[model samples]
Target: MHETEVVGLNVQRRRRGWPTLDIGPFFMFFGIAGTDHGREARMERRFEQEYFSNAVTLHLASALSPGTYALHGLPEEANKRGWTVGPQGGNPTGHLSADGLDELRGWMRRTPSQRDRRVRPERMLPPA
Candidate 1:
């Protein structure tokens, strides 16, 4: 199922026989503990630099709306709810610094537009 609930709110709705949102790979990262770093902070830093520093992370962070990740996706009733409550029913939050915004804008301009890209069904999970 594409639907997911967070804090009493249902985010994303997929109907049978209807067109579905074709978000690519749903990456779930698992970190190996107690690797080279002895301390937790050092390990976390290394992990972020190595794993989190990727095109997918950058695109998601830049492309999504401020609260897009709050409840995993945009809430079904987001228009009615306004900014007070997030999609997850928690405080709405997400921000980018001035430099970050500039960088994102540059990257977006350089990247080819994906509007015409053909989506392959085989790459996506079947709708439930």
Candidate 2:
């Protein structure tokens, strides 16, 4: 998986685990050092995943008090008609120190375009 700091990006290395191989199958990842307002301690378990043919991305962001989070992965359906997030959609696999599940479940931000939701007229489209 990919690791990127949304706020302060400190990229130590962004290359194959072993760069010597012309086409190495594995990538490298490093932990970030940051101050979090809060942290939920998941039970803790080994988490590792790798794909020989595709790339994955991850996002990490933290702020004071609380914020909303319902980032989407690729659309789950082959048709890509329905877009959703959280544990029910394009699920993220791994074990965390604390589930923070309730908090997570509470922040499934939805756009008006989602099913059953209507988009009100806006001033104008932001940009292309």
Candidate 3:
């Protein structure tokens, strides 16, 4: 997935989508606990240097969005009630799925323009 894709998802949806995410390997400086010069302060700087030192954090975050350190995806099909509140109850909560493995029951109900890439999915939503 990409940053624009992640930008389209809410916190709940993001959590539902990437349930097994782990930050330990995405960045080399991860797990910086218990250091000599205050791990909190050093970790803060490490975050800045790793992500904001360049505008590439967008790509980094996006790439990290779809990963996991262990098992991936839901354990069963019946666990998808979380997507019921989405714009289209049948529409999958995933943004960039090629096959829409996470798509819900009414996937075909929405018009093609509603899924157009010319406009972002989140941009189509009503104001929160």
Candidate 4:
């Protein structure tokens, strides 16, 4: 019932549908791009148009999804390009380690409950 739990379940059940990519300092969602020249061209154009010079990990979803997934590691590619690439400790940018994937799975599974307890609609209101 928790958001994380829901996310975890969604990840697991939709594993084939969820394609994650490491962009740079954060992970982005890429679910609409296909593995084709056209997609790549579009990405390149978007990157140029957006002035995205930073290094990024691009994840393209193979399923009929509607979004893409990406992750950014550092402030800039020049600063962190030397760092190893892969998944590690549930982090998709630390060496592509299974541990990272497992960790992420766990986090996704546990996030919803924690969020529910920590956040409430009334909390957004101005203090009296």
Candidate 2 TM-score over all chains jointly: 0.16
lDDT agreement with native, every candidate: 0.29, 0.24, 0.28, 0.28
Poorest 10 consecutive residues by lDDT, candidate 1: 115-124
Ranking by lDDT: 1, 4, 3, 2
* Candidate 3 regions with alpha-carbon error over 4 angstroms: 1-38, 56-128
Candidate 1 residue-wise lDDT, 1-128, digit = tens: 13222222112222123223322222223333333344466555554444322212221211222333322233222212122223434333323333433443443344456322111111122238
Task: Report the Cα RMSD per candidate.
Answer: 18.9, 18.6, 16.3, 18.2
**In terms of TM-score, how similar is model 4 to the real structure?**
0.20
The regions of model 1 sitting more than 4 angstroms off are: 1-85, 88-93, 111-128
lDDT of 2 at 113: 58
lDDT of 2 by residue, 1-128 (tens): 23222222111222234322312223222444454332222111111111111121223342211222223332222111121224433222221111222222223234545322111111122236
State, as a TM-score between 0 and 1, how close model 1 is to the true structure.
Answer: 0.20
Best by lDDT: 1
Winner on lDDT (1 vs 3): 1
Ranking by TM-score: 1, 4, 3, 2
